[model samples]
Structures are given as C-alpha cells and as structure tokens.
Target: MWIATLALCLDEDYELIDLMEQMKREAGVRENCFASLGWLLHAKGEYEKARSYVQQLLNEHSLLDEPAIRLCYSILGGVATAFKEYDESLIYCQHVLKLCQKCGEDAPLPVAYQDIGEAYYWKKDYDLALEYEQKALDLLPEEHLQRSYIYRVIARVYRATYHYDLSLSYHQKVLDIQKKHLHENHLDFAAAYNSIAAVYHNMRLYEKALGYLNKALSICKKSLPVNHPDTQRIERNILRTINHYNRKRQYKVSNIILLYYLKSLKSDLPDTEHETCSILVRFLFDGVM
Candidate 1:
C-alpha cells in the first residue's frame, strides 16, 4: 500500500497501474485500492477513468463507510468542478458538508467549503465566493498545509470584485504561506507572484507590478521551458507593462526609466504622453486601467 501511495505521488502512473493489477489479482480488489487509483487518475487529468473506479467502489456491497462516502462525493465534486459544472459541483459539495457534519469529521469541512467557494467563483458570485472561502479558512486548522489554496481563492474573489488592495493582500498571504511550505521555484509560488502582479497592475502601480512579474518570469524561466504557455504569458505581461510605463511622463522621469527615451526626439513625442503609451492608453480606453 505504501509503495502504491509513493508511486502515485511520484506520478509513476504505469507503476501504479501494475501494482493495482497485482493487488486485484491477489485480493480480489479492495475498496481502498480503487479509491487510491481513482485519485491517481484524477491527478493525471484522466477524470473519466478516475470517476469509473470511484463509482465502482461506491457500488460495493460492503455497507458504505463514512470515509468512503465522503471521499466519493469529494472526488465527484472535484470532477464536476474540473468540467466547469459549478452547479453540480455545489450539490456534491453540499452533500459532503452534511456528511462531515454528521460524522463530526472536521477535517473534511475545509475541503467542502473550498469546493463550494470554487463553485460560486465559477458562477461569478464574488460575494458568495468570499463568504465560503472565509468560512473554509475559519474551519481549517492553523497549520493546514493547503492554506495557500484558501488564500488564493480569496484573492481571486477580491480581484473579481475589483478590490485590488484586498486582492494584493490575500495574494501576498498566499505567497508567504507557500514560501514556508513549498520550494522557492515551485509553480505555486510563480502563480502567487503572477496574482500579486496582476493586482498591482490593476492599481496602476506599474513598478511594483513589474517587479513581481519579473520574479514570476524568472521562476518560470528556471523551472519551465521558454515555450511553455505560462512562461510566455508572464514574459508578455512584463513586456506589456514595461512598454506601458515607458511612455508615461512619470515613468520617464523616474531613475529606472530607460535611457533610450531620453535620446529620442522629444519634440515628436505626444504632449500628454498618453498618445505614445499605446498599452496604457488602450487599457484606459478599455476601462481596465
């Protein structure tokens, strides 16, 4: 069992499959093995395959145990969320929440809340998203390792509501918590930096935004190939922000401003600088800046 668990974590899907086959041949298939395999397949993004195993486990003749039932609903809810079926996800989450409450299993409460929050977020109900996320955080133990996810969800909700300051705050909280638990170059850290940069960009704090964007770019460059979509997107965002700020009069006067602008024909530049700053002007016109 421990070997199978390690294989799952290591993402050795073939090894996990072989181990499960052997287990099935030897023991006539166990509920725990099916559940574990379901999670493994889910992590690998084979949602349908995972769901099939989970459903088989749920149909077992053995009286449905509390843990098995909770896990089944949780996995089903996750699959629904993955498919962007938020309403269906919420239904399964509600079921899981009730089961957790009945069994006095506080450990699953945070997961249930987080799933519901995500469903609301996908539904564009920012208020409900924040409400459920906060409830999840309140129920979660202080030392919970997944606290970064809660912070990230709250940050996303705040961003959707146009609360840039609050969004930045929660993103920073996620970064701090992730830094303590994850490696410096972890993808999660890069995501947190990106989120923070986005809020700063929305607030017109170009320099601060560029700083975090660059950090995200650096991490992506080190950990991911240059052609990776996320790395390219981060680079593009950094370039766009730099271009926007470069043509601004305030940024032009800053010490960090590029010296090439100083050598350019000042008389030919637009009087208000807005005309020359294509990205910022576009953002303003689009009501995004």
Candidate 2:
C-alpha cells in the first residue's frame, strides 16, 4: 500500500498500475487491491475503467469492513471529481472523513481532508479548498513528502484565485521536495513544470510560459506513454500558448481578414470550426502572425 501510494505521489502511474495489478493477482479482491487499483487508475486518466472497477467494489459494499469501505468511498470521491460531480465528490469524501474519525487513526485523517479539499477546489470554493488543504497540511510533518500533494492543491487554488505569487511559491516548494527525493527525470518534475508554466501563462509571461511548457513536454515524452493524457494536455497547452502569443502581436489587414474568414465559417461548419481555425492558423501563418 505504501509503495502504491508513494508511486502515485511521484506521478509514476505506469509503475503504480503494474504494482496494483500484481497485488490484485496475488491477493484477489479482499486485500483492498481493487480499491487501490481504482484510485490509481483514476490517476492514470482511465476514468471509465476506474469507475467500472470501483462500482464493482461498491456493489459488494455490504461485505466490506470500515477501512475497506472508507477506501472505496475515497476512490469514488476522486472519480466523482474527475466527472465534475463536485457535490457527489463532497458527499463521498465526507463519508470517508466520518469513517476516518470513527477509526481514530491520525494516519488516515490527512487523506480525508485532502480528498474533501480537492472536491471543494473543483467546486471553485477557494476558501473552503484552502481551509481543508491547510488542515491536511497541518497533519503532516514539515518535511514529510506527502505534504507536497497538499501544497499542490493549495497552489492550484491560489492560481485559480489569481494569487500567482503564492501559487508559484508553493509550486516551487513542491519542486524543492521532488528534487530532494525523486529521480531527475521523474514525472512529478513534469507536473511541476506544467504548473509553473500555467502561472507564467496567467501572468502573461508568454515566452517564459512556452519555455517551461517545452521543458514539461520534453519530460513527458521521455517518461510517460506517448498517448498519455498529460502528454496530450501539454501538447494542447503549447499550441494554445503559441496561438495566444500570436494573437497579441500587431495584426496586419490580411491577418484581420483571415480571422474574419475563419469566424464566418463557424456557423457554416460548427463541428469542425475549431479544428479548421487551428489548422488554418498553423498553415497560413506558419505558427506565427
């Protein structure tokens, strides 16, 4: 369990999945492997597969002990968050919290708080998000690596609320910890780079944003599956940064006419409008305005 948890913290999804699968094969469903697998699958962006596995566990909820039940609820909470069912996520996470309280286990308390914090974060309840995330952070020792996860959640909430400096600080803290603990090419570095890039992007530091995003993309290509969602997301982010940078450049009459032409095609080809525009922008401008 510790290994799986640590693998997740490091964003080592491939290794985590393999470990969970091996656990499942050895121990079957009774060892909480299914619950762990569900959670890990969600981390890998296999949401439908995660839901299917976890829903199966839910079907057998009556047979589960309190710890197993809590685990299942925690996994469900994460899946709900991925689906943007924030209210449902909160309910599940709250249930996990209540279970953790009943167990009187300090070890599990932070996870419950973190889960609730994430749900609130996605709901755009930044104050509640920070409140719960701070509770989670307070539970950990200052040097505990797990604190990085809480820091990341807080950092994202700060970013969303336009607290860029605070966001960057927290993200840098995550990097500091990762640098101390993880291998140089670990996927967590890629995540941290992507997050820092987002801060720069929001600050309108387009060149800095592109530089960090390219660093992140390079890391992803080396560490993650070629078709991984994180890799795809970084690719999309690069394109978006390039487009945003180009749009802010002084436009000639030809550029204005070209944009108008694309806009006019939206109504005529609604389904392909975005793709058409993106392709045209890349082709006509050679990725520069």
TM-scores for candidates 1 onward, in order: 0.61, 0.73
What C-alpha lDDT do the candidate models reach, one value each?
0.71, 0.77
Q: Which run of 10 residues does model 1 get worst, by summed lDDT? A: 255-264
Candidate 1 lDDT by residue in tens digits, 11-94: 554433543453334323344544655665554456786677677778873745676677777778888887778898889888
What is the TM-score of candidate 2? 0.73
Q: RMSD of model 2, in Å?
A: 10.5
| Candidate 1 Cα deviation (angstroms), residue 144 | 3.5
What tens-digit string does per-residue lDDT give for candidate 2 at 52-94?
7777777877656676677778778877877889999999999
Residue pairs in clash, model 1? none
Spell out the clash pairs found in candidate 2.
Answer: none
Return the lDDT, model 1, position 178.
78
Q: For each of the candidates, give the backbone clash count.
A: 0, 0
